[model samples]
Target: MRPIYRNLAGLIAFLGVWEAAVRLGLINDQYVPPASVVLTRTVELLGQEDFLRDVIASMLAWAIAMLAAIGIAVPAGLLLGSLPGLRTATTAIVEFLRPIPSVALIPLAILVIGGGPESKIALAIYASVWPILYNTIYAFTEIDPLLIDTARSCGAKRGRVLASVALPHAAPFVFTGIRMSAAVALILVVSTEFIAGASTGIGRFILDATSGGGRMDLVLAGTIVAGLLGYLVNDGLERLGGRLFRWHAATTTEAV
Candidate 1:
């Protein structure tokens, strides 16, 4: 079967198991709630203006941060990757900074940029930048040496060689990096919203629901919506990437 059909089948089986477990008292219904109840609440939330606004807010922040990360990281990566000296010089600092958890910087972000979208955007950018930057630099490093030499032998200028050889070679890796960054960006956006307690976003909604009362159903519903959003975004990016880079997919399949 196609991957989509397989995914749907797995999801249905999981939900059936979840509902059965809830009904059979294998798990605490008060805390977990049935999958059907959560799905119903999710639909109800879709109809609410406030819930939609929250989703828009989170997605908006995520998009802005991801764009900013790409804009800043891609060019920087190309430049640094082209210059071995610069890349080597920065390796220690990059290694030091990259492993630091984005959440660890939330308090600093709150103090520096204040709360709400600004802080979340800053955090997401920090969190998402590494994947793209590293992937971009790696792409350049992995470029076939013979391709560059062939381009140069054809009397191609430095810029022409980069445009024709380096960039095309790196595009697939860049897209893969972007897909990875998009997922991380969403996670950071929602996590910042939860920790920073922004006025809107699904994470904020979940946080409020839990704090206001033990509204586990509503919380689970919001969690489900967040999960579905992530799945859709990743799936859409994957399809787009496949369309844009058919060669990459074929090569990957052969390698596998």
Candidate 2:
């Protein structure tokens, strides 16, 4: 079977089991609504303006974070990757800062930037930058030294060599990093919204839905929506990567 068909079939089978389990009282309906119930709620949420707005807020925050991260990481990666001296000089600082959890910084973010869009965006950018930066650096490192040397020997300037020989090879890897960061960016956005109790986003929607209690259905529904959002975002990026960089598509797909 095609992978999509297998995935669909598996999902259906899982939902069938869940529905049967709930109907048979193997699981408490009060705590865990059946799959049908949650799926209906997810569909309903798509039509509701409030939930849609929250989704949009989350997506907007993610988009801003991703754009900012890409803008910062790509150039920084190119610079650091090209300059062994600079890369070596900053290795200690980069290693020190890279391992700190962005979630761990939520408290600091809340205190410094407050529980606003800025705070969430800032946190998302911090979390999402690493993958792209590392990927870009790795991409530059992977370029064939012969290609660069050939360009230089043929009278190409440093800038010309980078722009021509290095960049094309790096483009695919940079895009792969972008795809990785895209998921991280979304996770950070939602996580910040939920933990910080931001005024908007899907995380807030889920929090609000469960605050009064006895709304497990709504909570699950919101969660389902969030999962779908993540899947769609990743899938879209994957397809785009495949189309834009056909030479690298197989590697990218396998990596993902």
Candidate 3:
């Protein structure tokens, strides 16, 4: 209760400062509206049917893309990680593709997938898969060799060794990758919606606000909603990871 109150106080203070700055003309209200105006616009947007639909559409795209990324990247990463030669052979290709910005691929995606949900989801998948793959590979490679040797000496089959030894050790890294991918998924989702044009999502809301007669307040409001959604998703992922990877918490405490 104390922590919650403290956080609320801090947020209030920040908003008060923002409002003061804008009202005093210390900041350009035309470009950066007051916190009060933004908040008002946010409330108005909440009641808007089209805006609500856009939020739902963006969330649906993010969820589908994330699931697809996890399903594809995890198994591929595990296989490559278990096989040193395969990991080595694919290293260059993976490195090359991983750094390619998802935004850059929007044009190609639009052309191929069309300017719709498909393009957004495809872009999200492209942006997200690398984190899971890289983390899975890192997790597998970093496992203590002694455990592998012990499992082998116990007459454990390859599958048994992987199940008992590798998976447990790598689970934390896998989740970490997933958490990272969530952020990527959100970024790509919004970028695709924005660049694709006339897309029915928060990005479209932002576009409409910006272009529809200098509605800076609406733009700020839309941006605030996007930021809140991102923060909520990230917090949810963190909580989920903590629950699924209790061993990670134990290990951290032990190390400290």
Candidate 4:
């Protein structure tokens, strides 16, 4: 079967097991509602205007953050990857900053940027930049020396070689990083909304559900929506990448 069919089959099997377990009293339905109940709530949420607004808010922040990360990381990666000395010079700082969790920065972001969409956007940008930056740098550094030499031998300037040879070679790898970054940005946006008590987003919706008399079905429903959102984003990006990078030679993990 196709991957989508296989995925649906697996999900159905799991949900069947879950529903059976709950019905048989193997698991408590009070805390963890049956799959049917959660799915019903999920369907209801899809029709709710308030929930859709939250989704839109989250997507808006995620998009902004992803765009900002690409803008900042791509050029920085190009410059650093092109210049060995610059990469070496900044290596220590990059190492130090890269390991810090984005969630840990949430409080500081709220204090500095205020507890609003800006705070979520800023944090998501920070969280998402590393993958794209590293991928871009890797792309440039991995360019074939022979290709660079050929370009130079043909009297091509550094700019000409970068634009013509290096960029096309690196586009696939850079796009892979973007795929990775997009997922990370979405997580950060939702988490920021949940933790910072933002007025909108799926995380906030989940949080509200939990706070409003322990609505377990609603909580699980929101969680299911988040998972679905992530699946769609990654799958869409993968299909787009496949179409755009058909000429990319390597059939490997990095391509996806």
TM-score attained by model 1: 0.96
lDDT of 4 by residue, 169-237 (tens): 888888999999888888889888988999889989989999999999999999888888888999999
TM-score of structure candidate 3: 0.93
Residue 148 displacement (Å), model 4:
1.2
lDDT of 3 at 65: 98
lDDT for each candidate structure? 0.91, 0.90, 0.91, 0.90
Q: Each prediction's TM-score against the native? A: 0.96, 0.93, 0.93, 0.95
Worst 10 residues of 3 by lDDT: 247-256
Instruction: Give per-residue CA lDDT, model 1, range 10-114, as digits (tens).
Output: 999999999999999999998999999999999999999999999999999999999999999899899988889999999999999999988899999999999
lDDT of 2 by residue, 1-256 (tens): 5998999999999999999999999999999999999999888889999999999999999999999999999999999999999999999998998899888998999999998899999999998899999999998888888998899999999999999988988998899899998888888898899889999999898888888785999999988888888899889988888898887765554653
lDDT string, candidate 3, 112-156, tens digits: 989979999999998999999999999897898899999999999
Order of quality (TM-score): 1, 4, 2, 3
Q: Is candidate 1 or candidate 2 better by lDDT?
A: 1
lDDT score for residue 194 of model 2: 87
- How many angstroms is residue 252 displaced in model 1 relative to the true structure, after the best TM-score fit? 4.2
Q: Which ranges in model 2 have alpha carbons more than 4 Å from their true place?
A: 250-256
Tell me model 4's lDDT, rounded to 2 decimals: 0.90
Judged by lDDT, which candidate is best?
1
